[model samples]
Every structure is written in structure tokens, then in C-alpha cells.
Target: MILFCPPGVYRAQSDTELLAGRLARHAAGRDVLDLGTGTGALALAAWREGAASVTAVDLSRRCVAATRLNCLLHGAPARVHRGDLFEPVATRRFGMIVANPPYVPSETSVLPRHTPGRSWDAGPDGRAVLDRVCDGAADHLEPGGVVLIVHSQVCGPEATVERLERTGLTADVVERARIPFGPVMRSRANLLERRGLIEPGDRLEELVVVEGRRG
Candidate 1:
């Protein structure tokens, strides 16, 4: 499916994005929710994979508008929502939840603003948004449904796994390891260390794909 993405839209150009597409392939015809649906990348991908319905949510008005336009462009059945986390879609549930939320440490000043590239900042410690996502996911997922999240190991992959487990969700690393730093990926280590978001002895890694399932 083709999406007319705008500038500053954080389009996924990594293996984790590919993992999302692959997950969609394995779960075709399921109802899907794409959180932080910037440019409707994963949302459109799920639609292309035959998801019966696709709902996209993003905090950015530009992102919502772009997602709607992209859905129309691809003739995909996607509803775009403008709100934080899962607020707009509270009354609904889905068989699959896919997100590439902002996972960069707030100490890193490389994130794009809400107007343009608000897709990579995860407040302090880089788990701000991700924590919220994990905390709220169980409520929105149907029985035996899956929540697929794409984040960086720099954002604490093991911590994310633990968080999901504590939230009553079983989690695993679908894909992991270091990838090249984009313009946004730069300076995370230094900034995080400087701000104490990461300790000197911390084993900070790069990027990974985290997948969790609601039991």
C-alpha cells in the first residue's frame, strides 16, 4: 500500500519495521491497531496484509491527517485518531496492536518536535511513552492477542520485557542487536550518561524489536 508521507514523518526504515510487516503477514484478517501511526506506515502495511480493519492513533494532528490521506490513497480501511497513547480508541479492542513509539532518551535532544518528527522521543529514561503503552496494552488487546512494539535497546529492552511481564503480559524480543544510528539515533549514549538516565556501568545497547502477548 502506498502512503503519501510528509516531511518530518518518522517513517520506519529499519528491520523492526520489517518485523511489523512480517507479523502482519502472519496474522492477516485480524483487527489491527497502529499506535503512533506516523504516516500510517505499519497501519498501511497491516491493511496490505489483509487485516479486516485498521485503526491508527497518533498524538500529532499532522500525523493523523497524513494517516487518513494515506489510508484513502491506498484504499485501506484505517481510521486515524489524534490523541495521546490509546485515548481515542478506548472503547474498542483489537486482535493486534503495533507501535513504533518514541523510545529515545529525553536527554537526547535529537527528536523531532510534535509538528514534524515526534516519533522518537521517550521522555526521561526513554521509557516514558513505552511504559504507558505497555501499561495500557492489556486492556485494549483481545484474548490471546499480540502487541508488537519497535524500540531501541538503548531504551532498556530487558526493562521493557520485565515491565510487560509485571503488567500480566508475556513479552519477548522478536528481533534485536545494533543498527546504524540515524540522525535521530546520535548522541543518545552521551546524553543519557550525562543526565544519569544511564549509569557508567550500564550495559546500554542499540536497537531491538519487542513483542508482547496478552494472555
Candidate 2:
């Protein structure tokens, strides 16, 4: 599917597609939420998968506009909102929530305040946004609802599962893939190695989809 990603809006990458594929398997006739919905890729995928409705939320205005355009282009019935994760849909609940948030371990403790890096940099441990998503998902999920999130193993998938579990959701790693380092990971290889997050000469990273279900 063709998508319009203006400068600074993240294009759907491996993580996005991975989560989308998993979402497709269960989204049929369900209300779906796509957090950090860059380019509306996952939202559009959910719609195509027969979701009853799809609501996409992103913190970036560019992403919001891009998602809106993509939805219109495909005639998908999706509502796009510009806001921080979960905030725009605080009063709404969905059968499924999917996100491919930033999980690239960075050199600094602080996440990017502004710039294209905001699309992928997730602070030093790469769990800044991931943690927020995990901690807040259960509140917006319907009973028996599922939350699918994809991120690098370097960001600590176990922690994500634990966080969701603490929020009273049954969580597990549903999928895993070993993919070559992308541009951001490649550029941070040295730092990652120094931090012992990856071994020397490691050019590949494992991505995992963490699934959390509200009971």
C-alpha cells in the first residue's frame, strides 16, 4: 500500500510490519487502536484486516496529517488524532491496540525534544516510550482486549512483559525476528557495545512482539 510520509514522519519499517502482520491475524471485526501510528500503516492494515473501526494516534502533527491522508487515499474508515500516547483516546477502549514505538537505545539519557530523531530515539535504555505504552495500555483496553507492541530486544522485552503483567494483563512474547541493524542501530552500534547491550561486531538485532491481554 502506498503511504505519504513527510519529512520527520516515520515510514513503516520492520517493526511496524511485524506488528501489523500479527494484528491482521486477530483484528477481524474488532475495534482497533494504533498508537504512535506513523504513516497510519498499522491502522490501515487493521482496516484491511476487517477491523470494525480503527483509531490512530500520534504525537507528531506530521504523522497525524500523513495518517489522515493515507486513510482518505484508501477510503479506510479511520480517525487520526495528534497527541501523546493514549491521551487522545483516554475515554475509549478497543479490542486491540498496536504500537511500534521508538526503541533504539541512544547514547544519552534524555529523549529527543525535537527533531526527526524523536521518531526513533527512545532515551538511553530505549524504553522511554515503550514503558509508557505498557503502563497505560490496560486502562484503555476492553476486557479480553489485546495489545501488540514490537521493539528490539535491546530495549528489554522481558521488562515490557513484566510491566504489562503488573498492570494485570497476561503478557508474553508472541513473535521474534532477527533483523540486520537499521541505520539508527548501525550508527549506535559502538555505544550499544560499550554499554554491553550488544556484542562487538554484532550487526543484527532481535525484534520481539509483546502481546498483552486484559482479562
Best by lDDT: 2
Candidate 1 Cα outliers beyond 4 Å, as residue runs: 108-117, 187-189, 193-205
Q: What is the C-alpha RMSD of each candidate to the true structure, in Å?
A: 3.3, 0.8
The 10-residue segment with the lowest total lDDT in model 1: 108-117
Clashes of each: 0, 0
Alpha-carbon runs more than 4 Å astray in model 2: none
Tens digits of per-residue lDDT for model 1 on 55-121?
9998887788888998887787788888987899999899989888888776544555544436777
Score every model by TM-score: 0.86, 0.98
Judged by whole-model lDDT over C-alpha atoms, candidate 2 comes out at 0.93
Q: Each model's C-alpha lDDT?
A: 0.77, 0.93
